[model samples]
Target chain A: MVTRSFPGRYDSLAQIGEFIRGITDKAGLNNFAAYTVEMAVDEACSNIIEHAYGAEDQGPITCTCKVNTKGLTIILEDRGRPFDPELVSEPDVTGELEDRPSHGLGLFFIRQWMDEVEFEFESGNGNRLTLYKKRTTASTKSTRQK
Target chain B: MEITHTQYKHCDLVKVKGRIDSYTAPQLAETFNKITDDGRFKIALEMSELDFMSSAGLRALINTQKVCKRYNRGELVLVAIPGNIHAALDLAGFIPLFKIFDDVLSAVGNF
Candidate 1:
């Protein structure tokens, strides 16, 4: 298990990506799986920075990654405003192109990519978002061929 | 991320390379805004070299597409989307939003 904390700002996205990439690569996750995990974590962190901390608040987002036989697990910790994931409505993805909405896709993407996602709020710990992705044989084979 | 534009006969071709996350999505949005502002509504985004894209990138595309639709002149199309990016679009249920082609020339010609 490896854990690192970054400033809750957009600028830290690159570092977060690098951190995810290192762990996924070390764990031998295929490109597709690794990319999926990276994007999921990216969206999660972005939400914490934008929605939780808001633009005016500069907090710290701590990320911990663990890889085992099952798959990779990522935990994002932020001491910002508490948020309820269930309150986010599903995006109208089937809507006409002209009427498509943009704001809700981040949480949508996060839920779609990760195998499991759980959000918890603690009085002192703030918000903890845990994301999990399972490695499949298909992913390993596809990645090896690439 | 690097965005390069080329003027075609029927549409404008924008080729994107590198990752499109929260930090870089604004640049893409700016490029699309500039293209539409210049009255070039028929556009083809070539994504063969684009390595990765998050929801922020998707939002930029959706916003620009809305702009093109609002003008009633032409539409923005996507071309040569890589497998991962295409999967992301599919997962987000956004595949049907635009005309997607396998090649840039074909996408531009359709405009």
Candidate 2:
């Protein structure tokens, strides 16, 4: 498991993606899976920065990734204001695009991209978003080619 | 992040360059609102030069798509979408919302 802390702000969110990339690259993860990991991880971190902290730059956002032969498990923990991503309802994108709202789609996208996404919240403090992605044969082959 | 706009006969082409994360997604959102709020639709977003996009950026696009579609007078075509944006769109199942094109000319021409 590798762990790193980043400032919970928009500018600092980029580091979340880079950190996931660094770990996945060293773990010999496949390109597509690596990209998926990066994207899902980024979505989690962005949520912390934007929603959890409300773009506050003073707080810390920590990410941990545990890698095994078959897959990667990532956990993002933040000590910002308490929020539950799982509770946010998915947007009604089925209707006219013009009538859609701008927000409430981040967690939906995160769930869609990651193989599995779960959430846990601590009372009056913060929350944790856990994500998992299993490595595939094609991903292994792509990693081997690298 | 940098954005350049070019107007054609039928639509406007807005080219975005750089990362669109939580920090910059608002810029994109503001631009979209300013341009399309007046109900002038048929805008083509040329995102080939865009290198990165986080969930905030996706939300901005989704919001803009909704607004543009509501006037029901025009369409928002995502033109020359970069591989990264394409991946994001695919993950969000938003690839079907826009009429995608390979190049700026084709996208604008289709309008």
Candidate 3:
């Protein structure tokens, strides 16, 4: 288990990606799987920085990553306004190009890429976004490839 | 992200290098805005060197495409997309939205 906290700003996104990449590499994840995990986490953190804290409020987003035999779990916590993910209406992905909505793709990508995701708000914990990705045989095999 | 554009006969070929995330997505948006503002709607993005892209980047592409189409000008095409970035676009259900080509020449030829 490894935990790090970063300023709730867009510049910290690369630092967060680097941290997750290091852990996924050590966990024997393939390049594709590792990249997916890194991307999913990046989207989640961006949401927190933009939606939760807004542009005026700059807070700290603490990320905790745990790797085990089965898979990896990442928990992101931020002290900002909490909102319901359910209220975000799904965009019509198949709609015509002119009709498609431009926004709301961030949370959509997070849910699609990660194997599991959960969001919660607690009195002292602020907003906690948890994401999990399981290790697959294909991922392990790809990791062994040159 | 670094964005460089080359003007062709029918369309402009924009090459992007580096990661496009929340911070740098604005740079991409600015490039698209500049192209569309000039009434050049037929655009092809060469993304072989784009290492990473977040949803913000996706939004920039979508919004730029929308502006182009709404004005009855043209569309935005993609060229030489990396696998990981392609997967991101695929997962977002954006694979079918734009015309994707294997090379800049082919993409420009489509315009």
Candidate 4:
């Protein structure tokens, strides 16, 4: 597992993206998987910054990326208030544009992009969200051919 | 980050020229929301100058698209999407979600 610490703020999003990109590239993920994983990972991390940390400009957010033959797994642990992904819901897109809200789509996009995701909490500990993306057969084949 | 705006006959062309990360995304969203809230639906966003974008930026654009689509008034077209934004959109399966154009004029012309 590779771990990198980031400031719990929006600017740290770039650093988070770079970290995920490095891990995915080493995992032999192609541009497509790389992009998807990065997007999903960024969304999850953004949720932590915005919701977990309440967009506070203080504290540190840590991301641990583990890669193996199966695929890539990223565990995002933040030292903020515990958050329940269950209570998090997708935004309703069917409503009128004027009446619509700009939030709630981050997790929805994560669910759509990532192969699997789970959320957990450790009492006084901060929230930990795990996101996993398996290497597609096509990607594996391409890697083998290379 | 740099932003340039060009007004067409029926719409506005906003070119975002930088990384739309978590911090800048809200600014972009706010700019877009101001436009949409004022009932300007026929809009084309020129992203050729954009270098990077986080999921927050993607959410902002998607949120704008949803707003435009909801009014049933006009369309939100992405014009000259740079390679990085294209890659991001492709990964998120958003290429088919918005009408794409090669140039801002072409995107605006469609409206």
Top-scoring candidate (TM-score): 3
| Model 1 / residue A104 / CA error / Å | 1.1
lDDT by residue for model 2 (B1-111), tens = 788877666777889997788778889888888788655777899887877777788788777777677747677788777664676676566777888888888888888
Clashing pairs for model 4 are none
Q: Mind giving the per-residue lDDT tens digits that candidate 2 earns over A12-104? A: 766677788898887677676677677777777777877778867758888888989878888889887777665798876565555555677
lDDT by residue for model 3 over B34-106, one digit each (tens)?
A: 8888988999999989888888899999998888777577999988888888877876778888889989889
Q: What is the per-residue lDDT of model 1 for residues B2-111, given as tens digits with 9 covering 90 to 100?
A: 99988876778899998898989999999999888898889899998998899999999888888887748888899888888888887776788888998876887787
How do the residues A1-146 of candidate 3 rate in per-residue lDDT, one tens digit apiece?
A: 99999999998898898899999988878888888889889988988988888862479999999999988999999998885899898877887887878888888887876889999988766799999988884274332110
Give the Å error, residue A117, model 3: 0.9
- Return the TM-score for each candidate structure: 0.92, 0.84, 0.93, 0.78
- Sorting all predicted structures by DockQ, with the top scorer first, yields 1, 3, 2, 4
lDDT (Cα atoms) of all candidates against the true structure = 0.85, 0.75, 0.86, 0.76
- State the fraction of real interface contacts model 3 keeps: 0.56
Which ten residues in a row are the worst by lDDT in model 1 chain B?
B63-72
Cα lDDT tens digits for candidate 4, A1-146: 89888888877787787788899999988876677678777778777877888866757888889998988999888878888878876666555445445566678767876778889888777888888888874274321110
Worst 10 contiguous positions by lDDT, candidate 4 chain A? A137-146
**Which runs of model 1 end up more than 4 angstroms from their true locations?**
A137-146
* Candidate 3 wrongly placed segments (more than 4 Å): A137-146
